[model samples]
Target: MATALKTVQSSEAEEIAELVALSRAAQEQIAHYSQAQVDALIRAMVWAVAKPGVAEMIAQQTVDETQLGNYDGKYLKIFRKTRATLMDIIDDKSVGVIEEDPVRNIVKIAKPVGVIGALSPSTNPEATPVIKAISAVKGRNSIIVAPHPRAKLTNKLICDLMRAAIVKMGAPADIVLSIDIPSVEKTNELMRQCDRVLATGGSAMVTAAYSSGTPALGVGVGNAVITVDETADLDDAAEKIRLSKTLDLAASCSSDNAVILVDAIYDEMLAKLVGKGGLVLDDDQKAKLQGAIWVDGHINAKVVAQTPKFIGDYAGFAVPEGTQFFIVHETGAGPDHPFSGEKMTVTMAVYRAKDLDHAIDLTNRIQAYQGQGHSCGIYSRSDANIMKLAEATRTSRVMVNQPQSASNSGNLWNGMRQTFSLGCGSWGGNGTNNNITWRDLINETWVSKPLAVAKTLPSDEVLFGDVIAKLG
Candidate 1:
């Protein structure tokens, strides 16, 4: 029986290897396409967005397969990509030819970056693939995606759909490709050999991509922290925090992991949060959830999504049944208090600060503990307070009066490139990714030169002489 099992596993492994080889071959073929052909591939992807139920079905299937998030929220992300992000790239000057000025004699042009190797995460499997695919096409690049091991089937199906869409739109047949088996070894080989790589997920994978000796665009982990000052509207802040935390069961990296409250309004804010279905766990409940929160040094997904009663029971607390979320109060912020860190599950740590400045200080501490350079939030009308926190946090995204998840992930106000994967910036203390965007996958070289004006001044003379004189 042992020998037979080994044989069966070996056979399966060989099949996966073949699939990876086929994908690589297809990517090579796609690399040979002309600029127009690449543009056609992008146009097909743009048109694919209009297909009824495609995005919705992809999102729902991913949630069902991964069991990590809510289908409704994932559906919204799909629609956002299809209707909003896709349109944003249409007719955008990222691809195609450029004409130079006759006098200036400078020509700016966009060129296709050959083949891209991308790694997608299970948390947002389908959305990540679609975002990468659409962006690659927009940049006139062919791509090969390596889905998370847990999301292989979903990734394969989505890749096929995208390829079919591109071919139907008169582009090359293999414009988008993926492998059925995404082993660490195979993925490492692809990343090292591919023209460029885009990695989205944990710190380990992003670090690997960066060290793969090829240009890589990677996204880091998020541990978003929100601060509520005494002068703020506690009711509105509570609602937004609830909305942000509960969205898709807090699977998003941008989900609010910690809440920093000013001492004057901590009780009031806690009251509103509890009123809005936030379960405050007692000491016994905290112990019960502690096991569920951490297992063998990592956060367990199953326990985090469990009901408050389940978590309480797991932590040794006797409580009512059907508790969906929990809130733990903490006096200070540090790694010793894991609750005060990024709890990806439906749990949050609330800290009380002395004043507005104290709240900012706590927020900084929380970021230092785990968040790093990702995103932070503040619920305040005081412009001074907002600016102060914004400057102090030094996070990539600082949201004001909105849920951190949506705001930090690419909602209208955040000004971040729209995508599920976010670059945690320099503050996350990780050097892998700067930010997540389609442009990050492609290489850009300006094809231009100085204008050849008939009556040009000498090299020492500035173009804007009068403007330069004003400065002097």
Candidate 2:
């Protein structure tokens, strides 16, 4: 009986391995689709988005299962994924044939990466998958998603719905796959084996993707800082800061973890902030929120989106009955200051600066202490000040007069492509991946032959005045 049981277990393991292999092989085949097929895939993805409440359901499931963010905020992210990301790709010329110059006789084309292995985060679980899946469709590639262990259920459900949509829309059934059981070992194996990898979330996973010997797009960790100068409208700035810090309980990558305020407006800003639901805690409340924020030098995952009252209770903060958000006022920037780093929660740190220049300097110091290349926010109407801060801060993205989370993700008044991930160029003093987009996932190769003999040089008379003028 023992021998028979062992044989059965071995056979089951072999079958599982075969299924994975077959799935990968099918993916390889789908990756070679014609442009028309790619368009069909995109259409299917759009159709999936069009399904009533599909996006909402995915977001709701993620929040319910993970307990990391609020449903309403996740709903907005999902809406963005469907409308901003998915629909935007419909008109984008990522795939198919393109004619650049008829005169020069140069044509460029897009080709799919063979197989993509995407690592999704626990936060924004649904949006991550939708983004990567749409990119795959745009590039005519097959994607296999390895969701974070904390988000397996949500990931599985989203993948299932997406697959159904694709099949219903006449695309291959196995173009997108999700591993039901995701482990570090399994994810590492997938990263090693896949043709291209896109990893988002914690630094550890991004590091693993970079070292996996596969072409990879890895996002850097974000600890976004926002600065409010004396020139800023105190009330407007305070309201926007409050909204940005508490949105989705501050689970966003671009959420304002630290606020640097000019001393001239510090008191007024604090007053307005407090009036707009910001909780200024006592020493005991500060200690409680601090404990709830960190665990063994890392941000605590469990307390990320919980109410301040709940976190305060857990941290043993003796406070009034009702508390919404926790605030910590600190003198300097560093690990010693918990708010200086990304809290992934509703907690924010307030730092008073001597002046506008000092606010920028202090903001730079805070980012340098941790988030050098991620992003920064400033609420200012002065173009010079905006340009000055944009130039001085080493971050890849700068948001002016708006919530950092929305602006950094490409929803700013200025036109910028929407993306959940921001690349910190070398300035964040990190690797160059300034922004995550479909174009980054697909590598381009110019298939061109040198024009034979430069198409006959212009006539001497035509060349003399025209060519000389052009040369000048």
Candidate 3:
């Protein structure tokens, strides 16, 4: 049995090598493509998946295959995510000379990073591949996707559509590919052989990518903690929080895992949340939920992205028919209190804070324990409080008065670069602090030209007179 397993592993590695080689060859064909040519290819690929009937088909199929997330939510992501991502990069130049600074005597040119190995998550399989594909091609780079096993079929379907579109544009179909059978060994092999890795999955996978001896960018673990102060509009806050918490059954890492409410308006906010179909669980139900959602300090796979009725039933409790989500009152943050971490379902933990300072402290503690460097949201009208939280916390994105899940990854209403991958910077053990997109897949070269005339540097006295005077 050991020998057979070794042989299978060797074969999978060889298969991945072949895929990488093919991707490299296809990428070479377009490595010198003009900006117009690359842009046209991107449009074709987006249209292939974002078209009306196609988006709905893949969305339904993804739900049927993964048994995660609802159909309507997946459909919306598929229909809008691809096009919106395109819009974000449509006007940007990714070819030849991309930027020039005459005053600095420098010119920046963009170049592709060869073949990119993209590891996609099961939760957003329908739109992630398409977004990554277009983004990769925007830099004239090819990509090979290693999708989650649960969503491999969905990934293949989208890849096929994009490949067909690429062929229709008279480009090489191998530019976009997927691993029909994905495993740890195969993915590692692909990452080792590719020029770069774009990992969008669990912490373990991201760690592996970083260790694969190739340059990689990975997203951090998401346990987004949001705060609602007395100054916020309770009704708007409640509605947006409810929307973010329950969207796609809370599959997004940016979903509100814990809400810190200021003492002055705690009761009013809870009432508003209750009005939005949130059922505040009693002590007994909360205990049952804790037991069902977490298994030995890890999230239960059976509850992830599942409906409220399904989760309640699994916990040996029954929620009311109209309950869209569950709210549990909690006073702690950390391992001892499992509710402080990410739930990945339609359950949110609610906390009470004495004021804005206390609320910011709670948010920082909760994020430090789980979602450090990822993101957080604030529903406040006070610029001072917003800036205070922004300065106090070590988060990459601090959204204001917006649904985090909808706004963190970009939406029609926000300026965030539309992307499925959110880099958590060094704080989250990732490299960047920006939303990962087409701009991340390219290499830039700086060309320096001599200035017409040279100038002497300023004297130390002129530069530091104020400091010298203070010392005197």
The candidate maximizing lDDT is 3
**Residue-pair clashes per candidate, as listed?**
10, 5, 0
Of 1 and 3, the candidate ranking higher by TM-score? 3
Quantify all predictions' global Cα lDDT against the true fold: 0.72, 0.76, 0.93
lDDT of 1 at 471: 82
Output the worst ten-in-a-row residue range by lDDT, candidate 2.
Answer: 11-20
Candidate 2 wrongly placed segments (more than 4 Å)? 1-24, 27-36, 98-106, 318-323, 412-414, 427-431, 448-472
Write candidate 1's Cα lDDT for 1-472 as tens digits: 9999778666655654554455556555554456556556765664464356777787778777877777777776766655555555554566434445555565556565667788888777756777788777666666778888888988887888777787676665565778677777667767776777888877788889989997877765577888998779888998899888888777777887888888888888989998878888777667667777888778886754344554565667665554446788876767578887777787888888889888777877777887777888899989999999888776877888988887765665555566665676666544443446555655555555654545646653456667767787
Q: Give all TM-scores, in the order shown.
A: 0.83, 0.87, 0.98
lDDT tens digits by residue: candidate 2, 1-472: 9999778656545543544565567666666676667767766765575356777777778888888878877887776645676655567787656447666667777777767888889887877887888777678777888898989998898788778888886776677888888778678777877778888878888888889998877777788888888788878888788778777777787888888888888888888888877788777667777887788998887788776766766787654654446678877877877678778888888888887788778878787777778888898878898999888877788888888876787763656667776778765434554567777667576667787767678677776977767787
Instruction: Output the TM-score of candidate 3.
Output: 0.98
lDDT of 2: 0.76
- Evaluated at residue 270, the lDDT of candidate 2 is 84
The best candidate by TM-score is 3
- What clash pairs does model 1 have? 104-451, 104-452, 287-315, 288-314, 288-315, 288-316, 289-315, 308-323, 373-427, 373-428
After superposition, the stretches of candidate 1 with alpha carbons farther than 4 Å from their true spots are: 1-51, 96-108, 304-324, 412-414, 429-435, 451-472
